[model samples]
Target chain A: MKSRIFVTLKNGVLDPQGKAIHHALEGLGFAGVSDVRAGRLIEIEHDENVSKADLEEMSRKLLANMVIENFEIESN
Target chain B: MRAAVIQFPGSNCDRDMAVALRDVMGADTSLVWHRESELSDGLDFIAIPGGFSYGDYLRSGAMAARSPVMQAVIAAAGRGVPVLGVCNGFQILTEAGLLPGALMRNAGIRFVCRKVRLKVENSQSIFTSHYDADEEITIPVAHHDGNFFADEATLDRIEGEGRVAFRYAEPVNGSARDIAGILNDAGNVLGMMPHPERMIEAMQGGSDGRRLFQGVMEGLIREIA
Candidate 1:
């Protein structure tokens, strides 16, 4: 089994990297780009016995800091 | 006072913290490795020093916070043992849930490294007793992720409870409310981005940082007495 965790800063949290990328895109003559928020994708390979609850625990404990970020898990 | 400095792999400031506690503050101090699940007994202070722990992988201080030694650290903190986390140590404390808020990337998108002025916010805590209230001091802050962030309610709560220990006198990083250091609700733990251990001696350009350790010693002595 495999899983993917998408970690992103919460909506109100300031994302400096995302802001810089947005600036660069605008400087490169791109139009209608309102905002950009950067995030991370973490891929994991695990045994089939790993339950969704276990994955959620992993995300809560380490994959995302609830203070400023949120994580979504997908499994296949 | 008896103290211990937790040393994670790549913790560059462990020696400096040990030196500050042992040589500068005249306390008996030891370096405890991260793999150890137990801490020595009768410790008055525990320091988590600054460094690229676990190479800042998966987020700064995330891995190190979950290290074996942290369980001991968390237990010690629960016992009201004084814990100080500097720079990456601050990140670790937040990740460990010992402190509120998280440190984010600098708003300027640059690594901030320099001596910056800080105002003592609340000098009544065990960590800030040596400094006068509202006193301005200069300390070196070197960090890529030093901007502190928290929900508005948390910010108001900490401020209302007088848990803010230090605030930047000038804009250095875009920290919320210019917070430079903060205390846990119990007032036994402190986490900050500045490296006070680096400014402990006059030869180190200033002795402002020495007062922090002195304050801790004073508080411990008061406890013993």
Candidate 2:
């Protein structure tokens, strides 16, 4: 089974990198961009025996820092 | 005093930390590698030095936090052993769940490297007992991801509990409450962005950082005695 995990900063947490990207876009004359939030995508290749709970555990334990980030797992 | 410096594969400050503890602080210190599952017994202190551990892969300090040696560190911390995490070590502690909050990228999106003024917020901690309360000191901070972030409730709780050990005297990083360093709930673990080990000697610009290690040594000696 293959899984994709999206990790992102939790709401109300400052996103400095995302803000920098937004500034760069404005400097390049791009308009109508309200905001940008940066995050990470982790792709995993796992055996069929790996259950969803295991994936969630992996995300919680290693892939995402629960302090300021949240993770969502998607299966394909 | 007997101390150990935990050295991850990419840790660049392990020697500096060892030197500060062994030579400056006059403690018998050893460098323990990350792969070592067991730490030497009877350790008075454990120093996790700053560096690009695991090349800052996944997230800053994420991979290094899960390394085998960290289990021993956590166990030791649970036993009330004093642990100091500096800069990247601070990040690792948070990732390892030894400390609260996460260090994010600098608000300016630049790697900040310079000596900045810090206020000793809680001199009562074993880590900051050498400094006077609210005393301003200069220390070097070098990190790209040193902006500390924690929820409002946690911030309130730590502050209410007087767990903040150090605060930035000026705007250096966009840390909440301008927190430069903080102690764990048990006050046995400290995670800070500033490098006190780097500022231990006068030749290194200032000796303000010396007191931190000395304070820990004295505190440990008192405990042992």
Candidate 3:
């Protein structure tokens, strides 16, 4: 079994990297760019017995910093 | 005062911090590696020295925060031991949940290295007791991700709670409200982007940073007495 975690800066958090990326897009002549917020994705491979709670705990412990980032988990 | 300096793989300033604490403050200091599961007992203070920990891989201090030794440091912090995080250490503290906010990329997207003026916002804390409030002091900051970020409410709360320890007098990085350093709610943990360890001596161009260690040492002596 494998689980994927998406880590994103919370709403209202400033992401300068994402903004720079947005500006780079504009500089390269790409128009209609809305906004950019940088984030991370982690894929975890676990055994079949691994539960959602375990993955959530993983995210809370190491994958996401609750002070600034929010994380969601999806198993497939 | 007994202090421990946590050393990560790429921690270049651990020795500098140790020398500052040992020579300037005369504190009994030890260097603790990241793999250690337990810190030496009865530690009065812990200094997370600045450097590109883990080569600043996957965000500054991100990998180091999960190292085994951090658990002991976090435990010591919860026990009310003073923990000071400078530069990359600041990022580790935030990553360890010891402090709020994140040190993002510099607004100019370049590594800034120079002496910058900082305002002593609150001199009452154990870390800044030797300085007067609103005093302008120069400290060196060298980092690529020293831009501090927090939401408005949290920023206001941090300011309201008197947790803003050091404020940059001028814009060095694009930190929110020019916050250069801050303390945790319990007042035991401090995370700041400026490198106080770099400015502890007159030969270092300024001695403004020496007072922080002196203040903390005095506070620890008083506590021990």
* Maximum-DockQ candidate: 2
Q: What residue pairs clash in candidate 2, if any at all?
A: none
Candidate 3 Cα deviation (angstroms), residue B180: 0.8
> For residues B1-225, could you state the per-residue lDDT of candidate 1 as single tens digits?
789999998799999999999976688999999999999879889999999999999899999999999999999999999999999999999999999999999999999999999999999999999999999999999999999999999999999999999999998879999999999999999999999999999999998999999899888998989
Q: Candidate 1 — which residues are off by over 4 angstroms?
A: none
Give the Cα error of residue B157 in candidate 1, in Å.
0.3
Listed in order, the DockQ scores are 0.93, 0.96, 0.57
lDDT of 2: 0.94
Query: What's model 1's interface RMSD, roughly to a tenth of an angstrom?
Result: 0.5
- lDDT digits (tens) for residues B188-207 of candidate 3: 89898888888888888988
User: Fnat of candidate 1, please?
Assistant: 0.94
- Cα lDDT of model 2 by residue, B178-218, tens digit: 99999999999999999999998899999999999888888
Per-residue lDDT of model 2, residues A39-58, tens digit only: 99999999999988999999
lDDT per prediction?
0.95, 0.94, 0.91
| Lowest summed lDDT window (length 10), candidate 2 chain A | A67-76
lDDT of 3: 0.91
In model 2, what is the error at residue B54, expressed in angstroms? 0.6
User: In model 3, where do residues sit more than 4 Å from their true spots?
Assistant: none
**Which runs in model 2 stand beyond 4 Å of their true positions?**
none
Q: What 10-residue stretch in candidate 3 chain A is worst by lDDT?
A: A59-68
By lDDT, the better pick of 1 and 3 is 1
